[model samples]
Target: MSREHWEPVTVFTGGLKPLPPEGQMTGMYKVRRDTPVFCDIEGLRGDAQGDRRVHGGPDKAVHLYPADHYTRLAELMPMASNLLLPGVLGENLSVSGLVESDVCIGDVFALGDARLQVSQPRRPCWKISHRLGVDAASRLVADNGLTGWYFRVLHPGDIPPDGALELVERPSPGMTLARLWALEQSHRPSVEEVNTLAEAIGLATQWAQRLKNRADWLARNV
Candidate 1:
């Protein structure tokens, strides 16, 4: 596909405050504005991730969610439709055009002056449901494979809110985000499938290791 087919970033967001507590869970959920944000190997310079154990790392420097998905989600879960706006999902970049099916692991893109590579498909967590006040939202994301993807910064630089993201390179033996999500959701992926996923280029090291571990365990069990 042509680079012009790629989506343009609609909003860039970051938050200095923490997400308000609903029961015992709290985090930085409200990301605000289309400001100039600095993207380093770690993540957005000013952005704060409340739960460091599950977020904000070199491999997941930026979280991107497709703008189109929001409408579908709103229709699916009308109870929390008001909360389905940009940045509500704790994503740093909201873009149009590219969704999970279109993006592949190891695909590199140029966002303004910064270079980033697709790292992994986001594994939805309870935080999503907590944020939306809809207990089934996270499960729906996982089941539907509508969860967005993350990116690892290759070259740090300034990225404006309206910056256009263009594809730079795509690795061979393409593994699309949707495919990965399906593999993850499988009841029991074959050992060979796990091994293949672990060996895929452009996948984050952590995910590779997780797949490798699963393969090893499956081999031993079988």
Candidate 2:
């Protein structure tokens, strides 16, 4: 298997106080994914936002920092147990050893008892600088694209520390994490334009469906 498709070895969670019940970690073990538990979709809360870090609800979300700067994030939190970068996302689960190319929108993460599907890549904002140190968040966004996502929980429950991690289902074509990132940036395209590009990229059917869903979402937001 490609390194991209490898199983997630380290799951981490981030906070001002990043360590958990005990110090059971390594470079392979970092925040969010590294932590014993994770949560999302509840609401935003953290030291950066001034709230204790906890798991579950819509407030919980996941974000990923990449391995390219292992030496740096490691140093920043040399005594920290893990590094939690800000504004990257409401990152409930911070993952390691996984690549963005390996995921897609609507792809489900099967933790056996439950699952989470990729929604979209995080959009950068000021909160990042607040959580991660001013310039650090900017750098993460520019360098790694933060390369993480929001996983809507299909089944909310305990994600056992000792268990299997599997990819239950791959999203349809054109919905890969990379493709969704590309499509999200395509705000100027017309329906015809999107269809043409979607077809050429084999995203026609999925893109059309996604577009409808996106339209509904945007309409409600407006």
Candidate 3:
């Protein structure tokens, strides 16, 4: 496989205000387009994460959703197709080419002048269903493993809306976002699987710890 592939960033979205009260999603719903956003170790300078507890931090400095997934989702859920537009799902960067299956944990990429590392697969929540007004939106994302991915800023810089995201490094013994999502959804993940993921080089610390805890629990139960 090619060591690196480039993708065009289709949109750059940021917002400080919360979503509509009726939706009950409550987080930067009004994502406006910006030419280029200043990325720091924390995140976008102007972007605000409505719920800091579950979203945003150094580990999840940026949220990236595949532009291709939107098209697939539109076909799957025609009723909520209108809500599948870029930034509607609260992603900071919407890009084409790199999808869950292609992106691996710990992979490093140069996005414009900014450098980033893939941290974890996005864990879809109730907010997604609420935002789309479809009760199964979250479940669908989980099942399909199209939940997007998070990035941790390695070298803070400015990223343009149409910037080219180029993979710079891909670590060995890596786990793809799609595989990680599948392991997470498994009713009973093998101890080896849990241990492997827990020790994955590029995985987010939180996810790694969670996998370790799950492994411990299974060891105890079995």
Candidate 4:
């Protein structure tokens, strides 16, 4: 029998609080995407907002993820759920099974009532390690890439507490954890190298350039 590989368990959200509050955040959270919230594309479409709040909406940006991200990371430690806390993200939206990091800029998934379009990987900050713990928090952003991707709301609505997630399409077709890691082999990737590699995977031209730029910077500095 085919085992159930991935399943979104829950979607947690911080009602309305400080985005990334400085401290252990508890309570005042909502079960954002449990077995219900369906994701869909709406509002902005086919654009790279990076770390800007252009994906979800002008007021509230949403971080959607599959549950496996937590189960796996939580496997590392219990308190890691501290990151899962709601107001910690001012509002979080968790899911089960799929690696949130694996979702790249442009990938699409159907939540419950709507769909979500991936914008970019979440760049790790010190706070993450603080929430998830030192080692895991540090490695999560760098290696796992399970950083829950952002989505632009094409449909205006809320993901009810009984929706299922569906994989519509991947934004970066060829961009996977393994492929993206290949860019770091030399510790410095050239523009041509970055462009060719990223384009090979169906990455948007501009987004490819952005990644290439990151590699170039890494190469020059590190």
Candidate 5:
């Protein structure tokens, strides 16, 4: 079978800084870079996370937000269209062609010299709303299934600013990140489906635990 590939339009990285309104530190405002960056077990060398508890780690190393989602986001929030741009979503790699619907958990890819595995779909947070200046921005992304995904470094190496992200393997071909996100967000999810996803290979530990907990809750309450 032929593998899928995509070239990132831009690579971005940023340090944590105090954001307004609450002065909470954030690393969600990244700027484009023109040079290659090192990708290690933690993440891009210079990338910083305001809160490590939920943001950065081996299971959530690199973030890739599809460039195409910006257009729909702009339409959804015309007032903040100016803020809806590539790299603004705090993604490390801003690329088009591949979106959540096309990517599945356990899928591995080669970019530059690094090997990365799809860990999970990004869980939209209040930071997104704060970054975009739209109170509904986070919810909009979640509802529309536009939430980008994170990658866990399987083989660390330097990632260049320009190159195609080539698929190396797909272990769970039918479990796309979009489907997982939808199932997870559904108010009344199926116990069987939740249990299956909780054991999905390459899925982040935290997400799997959450799914398992949800399954248990459903078993008792539903």
Candidate 6:
């Protein structure tokens, strides 16, 4: 039991494919699954990312973009409304009743038999622009803090089709993904705040290091 009660709206998985005219590969075109999917330390079985260097890893194993975000996304980019849907952004799990501001960085949840920890907020990239066919798609998500969060598996198991995520622990209640993204977007965020956020429990190593670097730069330059 926790902040929001949410059942898995859908689970998605897909392999790499040419993005567009340029033929750049991307795995953002995930398809919804009606059957149970195996959750491993690496990720859901059959899930693949075009870019291993930045996309898939132990720290970024599973991605969840709240289904609630699509409405807001559509409001911001009406032209791309047709493309706004759960799993379209490459998320593995789609659920309602939860958004960025509702969960913290170190929150742990149990979905079916698997346990997952919030590792980092998903970073919006140009892929969103390509996926949505809107040049400002990525910027809109980033600027509005609509970017969802990622989950790193702690216990691998089968996630049933109708499974729900139940919050089991919250180690960094003050470090919500929304707050982290806001601080990162701030032109002159406090160095102390940045440093503290960099050390937030359960945050991804890459995200923590990036925050630390930002903190240092802010300390020296601002």
Best by lDDT: 5
Expressed as tens digits, the lDDT of each residue in 1-222 for candidate 2 is 211233343444434433233332212222343224533343222312223232233322444344433445445445422444422334444344555666655666665355666555555554444444444654555354444555656665455443455666664544465555555566644544344333332232434477666655655665
Model 1 CA lDDT for position 28: 40
lDDT of 5 by residue, 1-222 (tens): 578788754789999988767989999879788888889989999999999998989999999999999999999999999888898888999888889989999999998889999999998999999888899989999999999999999999988987789998988878999889889779998999999888889999989999999999999996
Q: Rank the candidates by TM-score, best first.
A: 5, 6, 3, 1, 4, 2
Scored against the true structure, residue 25 in model 4 reaches a CA lDDT of 36
Candidate 4: tens digits of C-alpha lDDT, residues 101-204: 34544555555556555544444455456544455665654565545554555454556554555667764655653445446434666666665555543343
> Which of the numbered candidates is closest to the native, going by highest TM-score?
5
Candidate 3 per-residue lDDT over residues 17-63, each given as its tens digit: 54544533355464655477789988877777767888999999888
lDDT of 3 at 116: 93
Clashing pairs in 6: none
1 or 3, greater by TM-score:
3
Misplaced by over 4 Å in model 3 are: 1-3, 21-25, 30-34
Q: Which order, best to worst by lDDT?
A: 5, 6, 3, 1, 4, 2
lDDT of each: 0.81, 0.45, 0.82, 0.48, 0.90, 0.89
| lDDT at residue 44 of model 2 (Cα atoms) | 21
Residue 54 of model 4, lDDT score: 27
- Candidates 1 and 4 compared by TM-score, better number: 1
* CA-RMSD of model 1: 2.1
What stretches of model 2 exceed 4 Å from their correct place? 1-9, 12-90, 139-144, 162-164, 186-222
Q: What is the clash count of model 1?
A: 1
Residue-by-residue lDDT tens digits, candidate 1, 1-222: 556535557644555454345444333465555677788998877777777788878898888889889998998889999888877888888887778888888989898779999999888888788778788999998888889988999999988777888887888345788888888999888998888878888999999999999899899998
